[model samples]
Target: MGSHRKPRPSSGPFNGRAVRTVLLAAGAAGVATAVPAHAATGPARAAIVSDSVFSNANRLHHTQTKDSFTVREFGNVRSASVRNQANAASVACSVDDKCRSVALSFQIVTIAGDVHRLKAVNVSDATNKYCDGCQTLAGAYQFVVSTPDPLKLDASARRQLADIERRLDVLTRSTLPATELQTRVDALAGEVNGVLKNAVAKAPKGHDRPDVTLHRRLDGWPGH
Candidate 1:
């Protein structure tokens, strides 16, 4: 008798660059906002202000490969979650060797009372790899206003949120250095904060002023 084994699927060498490009394209097309079910005039009224995804990859010949994934969330979040997926494979020959790697990350953000809380989870695994790392960085901004009505984002606030999403799109498609990308992201966040602050200050009297809290997070990367 002879033993038999199933043949493995044939997938060409993993092209990190191509994978990243496809992911970004899909992510850009998938950006959307979920509106609440009930139309109440209290704190129950909430909506997704902004949701976006980002990714990047690098390959050094047949020596090393690296990939990074990021998810950014903003606005009134009712609940949130994050998941990270990673994999790696290597083949060795007498003359040279080949290696492939991949990383994926997901995140969700939610709002509670006057505070926006974000929780994220990440997982990474590799075969024939020396080391792997994942990190999460989060930022939060709370806008407190004196009003009776539930927090209703005005037109300007919505515009700023849209701008933030656009900036993230640019970041993902850009070939700028890591530091430069960070700078652009930070600047956009600042713009959002400034817009929210102005809204809080100009809020009319008598009505319940809505307090806005902006929660930001970058999941699945080194140094968070």
Candidate 2:
């Protein structure tokens, strides 16, 4: 009923940038149907986003579009179960000269609140356009997010870690006046103690864990 649509893009691994662009465009066009996972954390945590979907068929435009997001998580998500899906079907460009499926896009966050732009793991029927008959182009995923034992550190903690590292490097590498060097050493010791102390304080109370593994070299992203 419409002009020949372009052949779908090749199926392959998730291209986060490309998906992100598609999602943004859809959002701008008011096509997106769901918000991201609730990110608020406190005594009252935000509810999980159970499911979201966008399914539309414009016979006038001879196009079909579908998008779904199934996401659930904890404020400090030790584990998560996520599902993302999308399907775009079109015969050919009708009034518009462009044709393509809009895939999934969202960012992943670590336990300590590190934001990472990641495309949902997908099995998609990328482009099935200009076909003899309409067929569904679908993307499916079972995304599981679990904290790796424990996150290394949040952004602020990472900074403190860096400062501690810098001080150690100076203690070992830089040759300074004895008094100044001793002063620096003392400060370094204090910094190290402060970090360890902070960790101890943050440890869960009344919980019995054999030992906590401190990821001294761990780091987190800026935006959560």
Candidate 3:
């Protein structure tokens, strides 16, 4: 058998002890800037931090958890008969059995004398880019259209106008900071508003009106 040879040790003058000492010193200096362990974890400080964090998380969950709803919005609605021209209409959906405050959608097909032929479409609050909060609640939908007919606006149209205005107010004032989804929502709201405006003012006799918006019921919470 061939005789085994010992591997030559490193030729450097530096020994393990010296190298280890240098490394330890360097490591200590690097960590020196960190906050002291005792200062970083006082009991009072820990309790405060934990409470704040928990409160924020709880608030977020409360906001995100949806209430049950059966409302839906649909396009291309029809009257009883394909030829039966319907008059001004409105549709309001309340998820709550009471329908006290429901989500609503509306469309104006044709204008009559003083009445704008309108219909309620559906309620939808699916998460989107613009209004992250769509039909979060059940509400009535209303629309007003005016034709050449010189009739007075009905109470239903007025009610819808007021509701629309209220919703707009809430959206502008209570909306949170923008997100990727919000961009899409803004675009959709703009499009819907434009359509409603055109339909509402189709009659030379009627005037274009601003939407009424509601005040925010939940604003200024510690967290969203």
Which has the greatest TM-score?
Answer: 1
TM-score between model 1 and native: 0.40
In terms of lDDT, the poorest run of 10 residues in model 3 is 45-54
Q: Find the candidate with the highest lDDT and give its number.
A: 1
Off by over 4 Å in 3: 1-178, 206-224
Per-residue lDDT of candidate 3, residues 144-204 (tens digit): 2233332223455445434444444344323343232233333433444454454345434
Ranking by lDDT: 1, 2, 3
Preferred candidate (TM-score higher): 1 or 3: 1
Per-residue lDDT of candidate 1, residues 1-224 (tens digit): 12111222221111022212111111122222333323222233223222222222223433223333232222323333333343333223112232222222222222223323333433333233222221212112222222332234467666665556555545544544434544555565556556655765665444334444433332222211
Query: Would you list the C-alpha lDDT of every candidate in the order shown?
Result: 0.33, 0.32, 0.23
Ranking by TM-score: 1, 2, 3
* Model 1 stretches with alpha carbons more than 4 Å out: 1-38, 42-148, 204-224
Model 1, residue 100: C-alpha shift (Å): 14
Q: Report the error of model 2 at residue 93, Å.
A: 8.3
> Each model's TM-score?
0.40, 0.28, 0.21
Q: With candidate 1 superimposed using the best TM-score fit, by how many Å does residue 112's alpha carbon deviate from the native? A: 8.8
Worst 10 residues of 1 by lDDT: 18-27
